[model samples]
Target chain A: MREKILKAIEKNSRIDLKELAIMLGEEEINVVNEIAAMEAEGIICGYHTLIDWEKTSIEKVSALIEVRVTPQRGQGFDTIAERIYKYPEVNSVYLISGGYDLLVSLEGKSLKEVSNFVSDKLSTLDTVLSTATHFILKKYKDHGTVLAKKYVDERLKMTP
Target chain B: MRNPLSNKITTIKPSGIRKFFDIVSEMEDAISLGVGEPDFDTPWHIRDEGIYSLEKGKTFYTSNAGLKELRQEICNYYGRKQGVVYNPMTETLVTVGGSEGIDLALRCMLNPGDEVIIPTPCYVSYEPCTVMADGVPVILPLKNENQFRLTPEELEGAITEKTKILILAFPNNPTGAIMEKSDLEALVPIIEKHDLMVISDEIYSELSYKSKHVSICSLPGMKERTIVINGFSKAYAMTGWRLGYALGPELVIKQMIKLHQFAIMCAPTTSQYAAIEALKNGDDDVVEMTEAYNQRRRFLMNEFKEMNLPCFEPFGAFYVFPCIKEFGMTSEEFALKFLEEEKVAVVPGTAFGDCGEGFLRISYAYSIDDLKVAIGRLKDFVEKLRAEK
Candidate 1:
């Protein structure tokens, strides 16, 4: 029943409990209660479409910018990163050592927009000292898995 | 006036290889074939030179680039063997190890957000180094049909305006694949057209069987765009000594030397002297070891065939990557269960990359005695598993 409900939800995110119960050969009230419980427990994060932004109407240019900044008198790296991260354009921020203090992953409509943000928004901050930007060529893997490949290929077989 | 907790300690996952190695370290009398390094001791002559250097009180740092003698020897070694000529003073910089050469090269070359093309199922350091360098690592999965070789098509596809450097770790790790001269010739035009830099890690150059290891810098019009990284580790069994060198355009070497000067003034003085001796008198030992490795290579391939595991015949290096998917588990699961059940250790292919998911890399650098023992254990383990099923 669980697999059936999951399958129904997977096929159609707007799946209703009555239709899900019929598909799973279960009672409607039980199915409705199960989904309600799942929702309450936050196991069902709202349904989302994997928008292929590449084909979407919005023009987005993703770039990774490395920023070197000193902390303010009372604040530290986390504070600085958090302040920068509040901007709607900035996607993520990582505090790294070596040459740069912060690595900001961001997206904008154009290169000029990104450059403008760096000059107007990022560098204008009290702590920001310098910035170097490198745009991404491609992302092969993220979040512990391949982003493109369907499955690992296996060609060999052995008999039991 | 500084805070007591000035350094915020960040806890990260321990390296998976070290995690497995630590587990194996606890097992008494385990015949392991897990490590990727060669089993042979550093050649006696090289060891003697290191001892001699220490005895002579040559403990101080050499030139920021490295000892002139060692660099000259490297120049001679490459020119004699691969027809590549590099000025010792300008084109060369000796590093802590090939590992350091890799790090320094990436650090010097990549501006933030630049992309470095790395073929998958490679040494694990490449990805982390790219991230640490603030460069994006674009992994191009090499197909099995290409003999695990990165094709010109793949190279062409992976390139973009942001692509900066291409890491070519030929006589590859994990898979014993070597790119032939013709194979490299095909890539030269593509690389040249893009005007991109190539970091070629040819540390296993001396271990090749069929054809000699070809330096990408040896190609016409490639010297300006290539940094050839080689070391005494795999060649002279000097992994512990930590001696490696890179030769390329003087400008790149200068930038790399600047970084090295600030961070590490010089590589170990003893290692440098020892490396000079290895370059001078190491070819015979390399030949003998390659012969030994070839024999083991044949044995391992035959064993894989008998076990009905498909394995491509590797031309260089000592690893045999065998597809182990038929056992009904991911590579990590299979490796863990195998080690638990049989007490034999091998690196799961997934540790290299996603393409390695169904494979397991077995190094044949151990003695014939250990190889025989490992094969017997493997046979027994497989039989027991089948019986249980």
Candidate 2:
């Protein structure tokens, strides 16, 4: 039941408990209780909407910054990863497994704003050694929705 | 429509369902629940297989029984999903949609004057196909009390000395009623007693909501006597692919293949290839599509309850047949008035059969947003009708 509820919610976050109950052949109260339990247990951390932000009347810039950090004797990469992820501009941070130790994504108002964050703020951190920032040109897809192109519905008006 | 037709064919009634589509197509702003198909396009991966096949130049006709691998996939699919077993080599033959399978079965099995018991309300093609095959179509009017299931009594009542076939359109269209295992169990005795063969159209089998669909052929000793028709149209959203198949006794299939060899030759080669992929990997797609339909089902069910419209909860297919008898208008009259007043089109129940006269079939295959608007329009129409009385 937990897996099924999560699966439905994963595909569509906006589905209500009543409709979920009908889809799963469970009672409304049961589904409601299960979802509440999941939320309380942190099994469901959050319900995020998948938006085609490009469709809106806003221009945004995003950059991916790779950071090489010196490992503190006791804390290793965890302490540095937490500090980087805590920033408001940092949408995501990961302890990557390649040439770079950490991969951080930053969203900003403009390319200059992103560069300022990297040069002035990110480069000044005590543990960081070097940083490489790459700005995204255009997003073709985001959160499973195609963002760069419009999807036209081609179904016919009538069929037998 | 050409000169090579018989007078019998000329007199056959045109479908009220298609007539409604003509009106819907002419109007720019009308939102129709009249089309009896899923609004979703065939999932991309399935379509990609067809595209891949065509790109590979797979345009030649396959064997009269269809590609062996596709036939095996169909057998394995039914076996895995519904516990149905058929010989892929000898007991299955792919045709064009379930429509062609139904027609082929009727043509191969019916002698002139043979009686076929067809339960109503049903999809529009049943009677016409029976007439084209020179069989007598005996209409078995189903009642609302019975939830449109064919009872043992109804079966016995419809049988005559000439009765040769019983057409079971379970998970029935327009009504959205399905016969559970027990309901099917009840009819086995009467069917066995009458020694009648069965033609079961399960095109919408994958759309059952609350329970898994059970094949009538899966009953004890019935597989030998049932011709099961199923296709990619309703389940996989591959309607235009023109691929369907028949699973039955070896003797029956052999005959069907013989007729098909001279007629269709085989289902479109590319569709058969695509269907192989559909059968092999389409379970997830069906589940996803079913989930969408279930959401709309709950919304419509809840709205109908609130509006006092008296709809029997249908757990199969994508339609809700709500009784409109209280409005004191025939189903056609109600549909026309609704269209003119609200610019929303719903298929009148009578389009399926005359017995469907007091209700309407509203397909829930559209997006929930569209359904909400349509339902809202319906609520207002019904409320105005009540207040005027």
True interface contacts retained by model 2: 0.37
- Runs off by more than 4 Å, candidate 1: A1-160, B1-14, B386-389
Q: Across residues A1-160, which tens digit of lDDT does each residue of candidate 1 receive?
A: 5655654576467755554454354678998888778778887667755444555689878888899998776777878888899999998899998988999999899888988998899988988999998876655655433455554212111100
Tens-digit per-residue lDDT, A1-160, candidate 2: 7888988789788887776786566799988899999999999999898766566888788889989999899999999888888889999998889898999998999888999888888899999999999988878987766778865545655554
Lowest-lDDT window of 10 residues in candidate 1 chain B? B6-15
Candidate 2 lDDT score at position B20: 76
Candidate 1 lDDT over residue span B1-389, tens digit each: 86655221222223456656766667765557777777787889999999999999999989999999999999998899879889999999999989888999999999998999999788888877887787898998876678799889999999999999999988887887889999999999899888789999898888887787888888899988999999998989888898899998999999999999999999999999999898888888898788678757867776777776788888888788887767788988887788888888888887777888888888877876578899888878777766777
TM per candidate comes to: 0.68, 0.93
lDDT per residue for candidate 2 within B94-154, as digits (tens), equals 9999999999999999999999999999988989989989999999999998888889998
lDDT of 2 at A87: 86
Clashing pairs in 1: A134-B113
Candidate achieving the largest DockQ: 2
TM-score of 2: 0.93
Q: Which numbered prediction scores highest in TM-score against the true structure? A: 2
